[model samples]
Target: MHIELKYGNRKLQGEIPFDAQLLQPCIPPPAENPALQVHRALDRPLAVAPFEQIFSAGERVVIVTSDITRYTGSEIYLPILVERLNACGIADTDISILIALGIHRPQTEAEHRKILGPLFGRIKVFDHACDDPAQLVELGETSAGIPVAVNRRVVETDRVIVTGTVGFHYFAGFGGGRKGLVPGVAARKTCMASHFSVFNKAPQTGKHPQATAGVLDDNPVHHNLLEAARMVRCDLLINTVLSPQKEILGVYAGELEAAHLAACEQVQDLYQPRTERVDLAIISSGGEPKDINLIQAQKALDYGCRAVREGGTIVLLAACRDGFGHEHFYPWFDYQDLAQFEAALRENYQINGQTAHSLLSKARRFRVIMVSEFDAEITARMGMEKARDLQQAIDMAHANLSSMPKTLVIPDGGLVLPHQFVKVKTFADPA
Candidate 1:
């Protein structure tokens, strides 16, 4: 079968077995008018008062949103949100937009323009400086002892609205919701502390099993983030669910936790696909910014590997144009031993280190052949084999399998989660 997968800004074509199962999220058609959906969602919010009613006139309001890395349909929603606030007697001067950069770098002027769309220049926009102590306000700690320092602008605002797109996160269950607060505008230490929950309590125990994707119940990472987010004074949340093509499918607005939960359920129903385990899985880290760096691209690897059996072969297409998302990320690979890596991570916890650990762990379980911008040596250092292209990677994977293997091809690995279907026998079923 001829298959085309996204590789950075371009597409790579390859041939797979015709019988291979093509996995993709069961996305509904894009909304005809996404802007209208945004308006309607704000008009009738879930579990909270209307957007206008929640805020009084002349109040200082801040809309916290994801940076350029994770597009939240902000261009479509921010203007409507500003218009609503304006109608509520809030002047443009009293309102500001804070980009939840977290530990990421500040957005460039072009990037900011893209994120804010029409609201650019008209409304003041500031990037959250996670490392700047002067910009952060400590708001106590979570039950799990994670410090809850957030951007002073968000904490001091009269009304805070968190906005982002909802998607299946590799860990912390799902993204969006309180994530816009905890790691989004949180301090460097707060972001690290909240993310450190992904690891087990014991040193050599590895990552907490419950910290896997598409889960929320008892997920230590999610719990830590939730606790930290609740420490802030967030008045509303407006999260969107996008189609695989990045069109708005649904807009969820209202109370923080409740609204985000509603969006998470929709993401589960749309993005999680069920299939039997396959011997070979070919996956792509969707395109452009999704494959912008190894840090972000690893999410597709985490989610796509679920469809492959242990010791199976995986052909991962991650452009990684920006290289390791962070400078500290690649160095973690120096500890080739998982146990040693865990110990090092425990000694000085870093979010990038955790991601590197996760990447190395997957490489150990599966023969990962990556088609990316990284050099062969870099790929080898990370425990992955580098291929010049998708076809070469496919040939390498096929050569490793002893026989003609069952295969699964996932075009949008970053957005889709594949689950193995468990066979159950009932009394009425044939034995």
Candidate 2:
């Protein structure tokens, strides 16, 4: 069977066995006009007053946006939102755009211009520097002990508007909503505190019971993020749900928690696909920037882990063009002994260190075959087998299975979550 997988800015074609189950996000047809939909959503905000009524003239406004790593399509929506804010009598000088970079690398001027489009020339734009103590303003702590230090610009402004795309975050339930507050504009210590909530004292176990994807009710990381957002009083939130190709399927606007939660419930069905367990899984990390680095691409591996049975094999396809996304993550791979690494992680756990633990935890249950740009040495050091090509990766995975195993192929594993199944027994009486 011939199939096409998303690669960076292109498609990768390969042949797999016809029997391999092809899993994909159940994204509906794209909206007739996504840009128009966004404008309409802003006009009729959900559960809150519209922009004009919400703010008055002479008020300083701070627009918080996701940075480059997050594919929010700010260029598409920022201009429209800015125009609306202007119509509300907010002057150009009174408005500022803050990129919620969190602890990620700061974006270049060229990249920022590209993300903001024409607005780059007219409005003042700045990237949040989480490490810079001067740029952060202390906003007291949540009851859970998270010291909430947000960007000074956001706290000083009269109104704050958060804009970002919505999707399943590997840990924090779903992305969007209060995320723009906790990690988006938060100080380094605040971000670390929320992230640490995902860590388990016993790192060897690999899973944080409350940090699993698609869960929120009992999720400590998510709940704390919400508390931080509320503590700062986010005025309005504009979040979008997109297709695998990053088309806007739905636009949500209004009160921080209400609008985001509504969008999550509305859009999750599009990404969750019900399936039984499989022995061998072939997965892609939704291509391009999603797979731009091995660290970010680990999200797809987690999704694949959900579909594959115990002692199964997962063949992952990612570009990883940028290598490991975070500098701190590479060293964890040097610890050859899993027990020793777990011991070290427990002693001194850093933020990105969790990614290494997650990788090792998944490796213990399933064989991980990685096909990427990383050299064999690096791949081996990461505790994964390197594959020369897609077919070679598949061949290696098949070798580990007994007989022709039940195979599953996820075109965009990052977005397509597998649903758990319940067993039912049948009884019959014979004559």
lDDT agreement with native, every candidate: 0.89, 0.81
Angstrom error at residue 138, model 1: 1.2
Local error of candidate 2 at 312, Å? 0.7
Encode model 2's per-residue lDDT on 1-431: one tens digit a residue.
56677755666776664357767655677666778978888888988988789988888999999887678878888988888888889899999999988778888898899789989989999999988989988989999888999889988889999988887888898889999888998988888787777866555664468787888988988998899888776789999888887888888889998889978986677888777788888888888768878777888998778888998889888988777887888888777777777677667766678778778778777888988888888887877889977888877877767666777888888777787653211111111
Can you write out model 1's per-residue Cα lDDT over 182-262, one digit (the tens) per residue?
Answer: 899999999998998898897798889999899999999999998889899889999999887889999999988999999
Give the best candidate by lDDT.
1
Poorly placed runs, candidate 2 (over 4 Å):
200-206, 422-431
Question: What TM-score, over all chains together, does every model reach?
Answer: 0.96, 0.93
Superposed Cα deviation of residue 299, candidate 1 (Å): 0.7
> How many clashes in each structure?
0, 0
